[model samples]
Target: MDYIDRAEATRRILAAKERAGLSFEELAQVVGAHEVWVASALLGQNTMSSEQAAAAGKALALDEATVAALSRDAARGSLPAAVPTDPLIYRFHEIVQVYGTTLKAVIEEKFGSGIMSAIDFSMDIDRVDDPRGDRVKVTLNGKFLPYRTW
Candidate 1:
């Protein structure tokens, strides 16, 4: 098996959609992505983001876990993992991921500087009570330094 087989995830997604009696355009429309994006991912020419995969799961009537598995496989080049030898740079990397664009947007809008200093950042997670349900509250603070110009 190729260590990174892009085709497998794409192929599986396409196959799953087909087996479920849906068309490419239909799936793409349901998932709120362009048809071209769906086609490219199905052809193994593109990668699907978690947001996209989650939406796709709803469109395809698939469990979130299966969609997540496909995304994970696609990231790894489609080979089966054995014990996940890769070290986690972020302690929560195995469970939580950095949503790059979302974080970047918030950072740019708030601090108007460069990224959060991973070295100088702090994270706090706590449970909060809500009328609807319990919610996990997280707060992050980091020193801000403007980007240096050459």
Candidate 2:
């Protein structure tokens, strides 16, 4: 059998999901993972566990090979350029460009000379209704790792 290409498989999976009108939240429920994580895995940024992959495959009506491919490590960081061209994604980049230093300084002052652990992070996105307009609330929770002096 030919080897499964994860990128291609992810593309196929996304197409099938679209055709089936399955939202990331729906698929995440099937796989028992957060919607953002499920979307990231589908977009080839993260690898899913075998059980999660199988659950996703069943929900998306994907083939066995594609399910197995989902369990493999993704190359990740598949951005076309250093600066993304997409408008929504670019706004995030702009936010970091403007507030990154301020955030770093604040974080350092609060947590000492160390960094937050992305590997041990959790994120939540929520929608809050308002009179003027709805608001998007994003929360990033990461482990505070202190620098060790040898």
Estimated TM-score for each candidate: 0.38, 0.93
Q: Write the per-residue lDDT of candidate 1 for residues 55-146, one digit (tens) a residue.
A: 77677765544566445533323224443445643333444345667777787898786866744655555689999999877676678866
- Candidate 2 Cα lDDT to native: 0.89
Q: What is the C-alpha RMSD of each candidate to the true structure, in Å?
A: 16.7, 1.4
Q: Model 2: residues >4 Å from true position, as ranges?
A: none
Q: Compared to the true structure, candidate 1 yields what TM-score?
A: 0.38
Worst 10 residues of 1 by lDDT: 73-82
Compose the digit string of candidate 2's lDDT tens values, residues 2-105: 45898888789989999899999999999999998888898888899999999998888988888888988877776776899899889888999999999899
Candidate 1 Cα RMSD after full superposition onto the native fold (Å): 16.7
Residue-level lDDT for 69 in candidate 2: 87
> Candidate 2 at 134: error in angstroms?
1.2
Q: Which stretches of candidate 1 lie over 4 Å from their true place?
A: 1-5, 62-66, 69-150
